[model samples]
Target: MLMSPTVRSGTLVMLIALLRSPATTVAVPPPSSVQASAIGADVTAGKHLFERHCAVCHGIEGKGGRGPGLNRAQLAHAPDDTALKSVISDGISPDMPAGWFLTDEDVANLAAYVRSFSNIPSEPLPGDAVRGAGVYAKGGCSNCHIVAGAGFGYGPELSNIGIRRSAPYIRKAIVKPGATMPEGFLLVEAITPSGDKIEGIRVNEDTFSIQIKDATGQFHSLRKQDLKELQKLRGESPMPSYGGVFNTSELDDLVAYLASLRGKQ
Candidate 1:
């Protein structure tokens, strides 16, 4: 019962095609119990690592304090697992110090733990965003903070602050500005050779020269050698604490308004 030459060639071609097709491959099942156990262990280890190394800045629950919240479904800088791992290892420059002591495995575990935070729901804002905008204007917040190309550039920009910082962190900042003075906004007081004292946030500095932006929004580049006195006020913030100014409701409203500023969204 030999097939015709044409039929034989067609059959051979079909057989080869079948052999090369992905449909012929076996489907892999989900991870086995042992593999699942290993992953669970990794996540547990990562949790411990986060508590020890990251909890101080990121908050004990990863809700955020000095750093951005990890509990959100998405992070601006770390949109995926790979980016999260890299950020944990390399850090984000002057704002976030690199995890120099962490090993590859440690970083993986830490990322897993941080990723777990996404499951936790974001906290709800207590105040009205509309009222908060009024509070912001009344408090003259724009004088120090910038939002969407408006306001001064003196303090940290709030254009995307809603996505970057948690509401609690923003509230804490408003109530106690000195608690976390941010990375770049270092307060400095310099005395000129002619007995003139100038105080401002340190814009930039080197061994020979220092640049300062005074409260009056003036830029002063002074030579270190010519200054009679140069005082670096570490852990000090030029932004005044608004604890006394804003009542409880006003404070809540302001926090809500700032948290609503997601920028271009």
Candidate 2:
């Protein structure tokens, strides 16, 4: 693959990894909107909109989830700021439904947040996205994580994980499930009145009831009175550490494929 000529090869590989690094820089696409890119425009407002409206499918930080990540070298349908506004206002076909509900100001603010992704320093990497996809299928990540909206909702969706996390972070997460836990995933153990034992991911719970989903996608809902045990193991997750599961090359390939998934169908 032809590496981007903009940066040194080594730096490019590390570009997406150092999103917050001062040295890391993404080429800001030429701004087409004077109003949207205005300094007075509230970047914070845009971030809020993204977190509220777009985070479900696009990811918390424009990283991607069910939708393609906005943090990318280039956009698929729109590139310039003005075009981005149209994308936000009109929404696109196939997958990206329109957001006609947003006000003009909301569109302006959201555009700023989307534009910010261009400067996040995601150039490219050595790992291959296609082969990495095969790795994902083989690794059984879909059993827990969702990609392109097809998987058990038990685990965090990985459609936009590449943009949400860096290559090294992704690698570290695979080998260390306990290191960080996504927002809602909490390990739980439930024992029935008959002394039947169950351990799986805690899906949801209420004062009177609890729900958990196992690896097989079987959901077990237990009332608080019936269960012999229910424990919320904080700082814990059901995802197993892949340290011994994959070799170094396989890990790299998997990471590459995951990073390439920016919500594209």
- Which model scores highest in TM-score? 1
lDDT of each: 0.79, 0.72
Top candidate by lDDT: 1
TM-score of each: 0.80, 0.58
lDDT of 2 by residue, 1-265 (tens): 1122455756644543453345433443343443236333445678888888888767787765546567765675665677888988887653466888999889977886687776566546677778888888898888788998887666778887754555656777789988856556678888899998888888789999988887677899999898888877888867789999998888888988877666763
In each prediction, how many residue pairs overlap at the backbone (N, C-alpha, C within less than 3 A)? 0, 5
Clashing pairs in 2: 64-160, 67-263, 68-262, 68-263, 69-262
On the 0 to 100 scale, the lDDT of residue 227 in model 2 is: 89
- 28-133 per-residue lDDT for model 1 (tens digits): 2354322222232256567789999999888988988778788977677777666887899999867678999999889877876787777678788789999999
